[model samples]
Target: MAQPPKGTYEVIHQPNKLKDLVGGPARMDERLIAKAEAALADAVSKIDLAETAKDSIVKLDEAVERLQAEGAEPAGPERTIYTVMHDLRSQGASFGYPMVEKIATSMNRYLELGEPGQRGHNDADAIKAHVDALKAVVATKMKGEAGAIGQQIVAGLYKISRTKSK
Candidate 1:
């Protein structure tokens, strides 16, 4: 049966209309397709789980180095760093490292602050602080919301973010 919204369809299987719909036996049914999809999903999940997450942290560290090197250079390089920081901000929390995400978010804010005077210096020190924060979280294997130390670090970064560095 068709549902409302003009064009919505519910894909269902009707076994009785075997020879009429396709001129032969309906070889594929919803159950078969669903089972196949589930099996594929399971296989893909297994493959995805096999990769070591530590490698990701290593890569992120490398990216931080690149961002630091690009420090307050120009918009192009800074934009690349911004993209990296943005990704880290969104991905870290999902990967069980909320602290990294928090630090990344702060870094993103720092990056978005425009030029140096408006708190958007994008210097090595400012970038390093956030990157180091990420490394700390990963190394310590911290999970969930961070504790006082993390808060302190973030607060420090944010403080610098509000000031101009030129």
Candidate 2:
């Protein structure tokens, strides 16, 4: 077979808007870090993690029920659960709830690995366990590992996930 002619492409470099805006790199001094930390603390304080997470967990529970009703198929509820879990994972750490982040991460992985409609009763139970864990975290306002209890909660969730039948 004759080889097709190679096409030549021109490379274009785009200007760095951020660099232009900031001018140059600045050292992260202690004072700057302190200021940033204070600002972050203030912003974090404004967020009611308990209320927010509880609301999301409620939605997650509803989605879980819908998913179970739909036989764990790919549908609006699955997407809703995934979205809620993702959002929880992202916000959990920032809000000082690392356990929430951990559980949500596990939930997301479960959703990702299991094929729609192929999930079984154990899978739904595992998901429910995740939801329960999240609820416990929010209800207790658990944050920053929560010591042995947090470790146990996360470990228990993993155990449930591992036991899920195909």
Clash count for each candidate, listed in order shown: 0, 0
Displacement of residue 152 (Cα, Å) in model 2 is 1.8
| lDDT of model 1 at position 128 | 69
lDDT of 2 by residue, 1-166 (tens): 9986689767899998988889998677999999999999999989878887767988988877876774455456667777899999989988888999999998877777665444644466678889888998889888788999789889888776666546
Candidate 1 runs further than 4 Å off: 1-76, 115-122
lDDT of every predicted structure (CA atoms): 0.64, 0.80
Candidate 2: worst-modelled 10 consecutive residues by lDDT: 114-123
Residue pairs clashing in model 2 are none
- Which window of 10 residues has the lowest lDDT sum in candidate 1? 44-53
